[model samples]
Every structure is written in structure tokens, then in C-alpha cells.
Target: MRNLEIRQFPCLSDNYGFLVHDSESGETAAIDTPDADAYLKAASEAGWTITQIWNTHHHFDHAGGNAALKAATGATVYAPIYDRHRITDVDHWVADGDRVTLGVHVANVIHTPGHTLGHVVYHFAADRVAFVGDTLFALGCGRLFEGSPGDMWQSLSRLRAWPDDTVIYCAHEYTQANAAFARSVDPDNPALADYAREVGEKRAIGLPTVPTSIGKEKAANPFLRPDDPTLAQSIGLEGSGPVDVFAEVRARKDRF
Candidate 1:
């Protein structure tokens, strides 16, 4: 099987849009439609037709462009089953373990209800790539908008099971700020420090720090390490359960 081609571009103020293409089938999918014009332009420039739209959640920024994009390209929109009521123009509803395909490339849907109650991520296991939406980020994770800290923690724990080399594509450009917050909590982590510096260098030159890997996030993101004694200690929650530790960390980040 051939590897799918991906295009990443900035949308709105901080959101990132993705286009995944399978050359063999001449099929292309818009990962999420933060902005219709942006995805349209990007697809036009790539000379690929938008054949499918995969939505990760019901958030406006994530699904707002669906109607417009679908109208323009006549593409089918696949959204999470739980949030189908919130998203318009959905042609299919997918739940955890459901598979979506772009030509020969298939992605498994993982229900990750943290940032929103019905949030999901698309994992293309064969390609070792995941479009994580807002559930996970570089050195950070999404806020508990509709779900509790425990809910978000459990959701993130699902992502932790992916292969370490899986490349994660989160939806926003919040790495620089997230790095600063990460350092404040996990101050002595060598991995976090290294990651922070690299993020700084990249942002200094206007480069994106996204497309982070499961390995890098596992090593550096405190949000993903709530079970670690060191992380728990840093938050003054020694011996606390992972849920408590995660809740404390989320609270701190909320205030950060």
C-alpha cells in the first residue's frame, strides 16, 4: 500500500487544517473543516478533489466549515455518532473502533471525550498517523469544556495506547504557550526542556510545532504523565491516583 500524502496549513487565528490524500485512488479527505475557503484553496492548490470530510467533534471551529465545503465539493461528511446532533451535513456517523477509508488507507475512529463530550480522533494505524483534533496537543491537551477531568483523562489514556512512533496531528498552534505552561509544572524534566527549546526555535522562525509524535508527547507532555510519581510530586499530589493528579494538572493549566 502507498503512504497517504498530507497537507497542513493554518486556518483562522490558531487553528490548523489538514488534507489527506491517497494517490492510488485519487481520493482526498479534509480532516476537519475549520474554514471552508482555506480547505478549498489548499485542495485547489494541491490539485486534489475533496472526496470526504472527517470530523472529530462538534465544536464550531471544527465543524463549522462542513456545510460550505460539502456544498462546494459534494463530499461526504463523516462525524462521530455521539455528536451527530450538533454537526450539520453529516453523511455518516462513526463511533469508536469504526473505520473510515480514503482509497486504500483506513483510519480507526477513537472516541475521545475530553475537549467535548463526543470528541474523536482518527488513527491511520498502517500509516502510524493520527488526527487528534483537540483532545491532545504538543506538551498539552485540550481543556475540559464539557467533560470532567476524569473524563478527559480517560479519553487521553486511550491515545496513550497508540504506538510510540505514531505521528499526532492536533488542531491548533498552541505549542509555544503550552510549552511555557508545561515547564512551570514539570520544571526539572530534561525532555520537556529540550522540547521547549526546540519549540521556541521553531516558533521564532514562524514554523509550526505540530505533527508531534506519540513518543515525544509521552516523554515530554505532563498532561500525558499524570501517573508518573515525579509529575504527581511536582503538583504536590504525591501518591494520588492518576485521576486526581490529572484533575489537579488540568486545574492548574486552566489558571495558567
Candidate 2:
């Protein structure tokens, strides 16, 4: 089978739009519709037909362009079952463990409820690629908008179970700010220090720091290291449970 080709482009002010294409079947899936015009232009530039729209959540920037894109390309729209009522123009409502295909590439829909009550990430297991829409970021995690800290921790724990080699494509350009916050709570971590340096360099040149790997985030992301003693002590919660530690970290980030 041919490999899936992904196109990532900037949309809105900070959002990123993705197009996943499979050459063998000649099908393309738009990961989200942050901007229908942007998706259409990107698809045109790549010479790929938009056959499907896979929405991760019901946020305005995520699904706001659904109707326009569908009307333009007649593509099928797949959205999270939990967010069906929030998003419109959905052709299929997928749940956790459900599978969706584009040509021969099949992506597993995993419910990651933290950024939104029904946020779902698409993981292409064989491809070792995950499209995490706001659930997880380069050096941070999504804010506890709809779900509690406990709920978000559980969601992140599931993502941490993926193989270290998995490549993660998060939906925002928040790495610079996240790196700064990470240094505050995880200053002693050499890995985080190095990652922060790299982020600084990348941002200085107007480069995008997205598509970070699972190993990197697992090693340095403060949100994913609530159980680590160093991080707990940094926030004065040396012996607290992971959930409580996570809550403190999330609260600090909110105020950051």
C-alpha cells in the first residue's frame, strides 16, 4: 500500500489545517475545517480531491467551515459521536475505537475529552501518526475547558500509551508559549531545556514547531509528567497524587 501524504498549512490566526491523502486510492481527507477556503486552496495546490472531512471537535474554528467545504467538494464529514449535536453537516458520527478509512489508510478514532467534552484524535497506527486536535500540545496540554482535570489526565494517559516513535500533529502554534511555561515547572529537566532552546531557535526564524513526537512530549511535557517527582516538587506538591499534581499544573498554565 502507498503511504499517506499529509499537507499542513496555517489557518485563521494560530490554527493549522491538515489534508491527509492516500495515493493508491486517490482519496483525500481534510482533518479539520478551520477555513473552507484554505482547505480548498491547499487541496487545489496539491492536486488532490477532497473526499472526506474528519473533525476532531465542534469548536467554531474546527467545524465552522463544514457546510461550505461539503457544498464545494461533496466530501463526507465524520465527527465525534459525543459532539454530533454541536457540529453540523456530519455524515458519520464516530466513537472511541471506531475506524475510518481513506484509500487503504485506516485511522482509529480515539475519544480525548479534555479540550472539549467530545474531542477525538485520529491515530493511524500503522503509520505511527496521530492528529491530536488541542488535546495535547508540544510542551503542554489543552486547557480544562469542558472536562475536569481528572478527565483530561485520563485522556492524556491514553495518548501516552502510544509507541515512542509515533509522530504527533497537534492543531495549534502554541509551542513557544508552552515552552516558556514548561521551563518554569520543569527547569531541571535537561531534555526540556534542550527542547526549549530548540523552540526558541525555531520561533526566532518564524518556523513552525508542530508535529512533535510522542517520545519528546512524554520526556519533557510537564502535563504528561505529573507523576514525576521532580515536577511535583517544583510545584510544591512533592507527595501528591498524579491527579492533584495534574490539577495544579493545569491551574498554573491557566494563569500563565
Instruction: Please list the residue runs of candidate 1 whose C-alpha ends up more than 4 Å from where it truly belongs after superposition.
Output: none
The digit string of per-residue lDDT tens for model 2 on 94-146 reads 99999999988889999998889999999999999999999999999998889
Per-model lDDT: 0.95, 0.95
Backbone clash tally for model 1? 0
lDDT of predicted model 2? 0.95
- For residues 1-256, could you state the per-residue lDDT of candidate 1 as single tens digits? 9998999999999999999999999999999899999999999999999999999999889999999999999999999999977999999999999999999888999999889999999999999999999999999999998999889999888889889999999999999999999999999999999999999999999999989999999999999999999999998999999999999988999999
Per-prediction TM-score to the true structure, in the order listed: 0.99, 0.99
Clashing pairs in 2: none
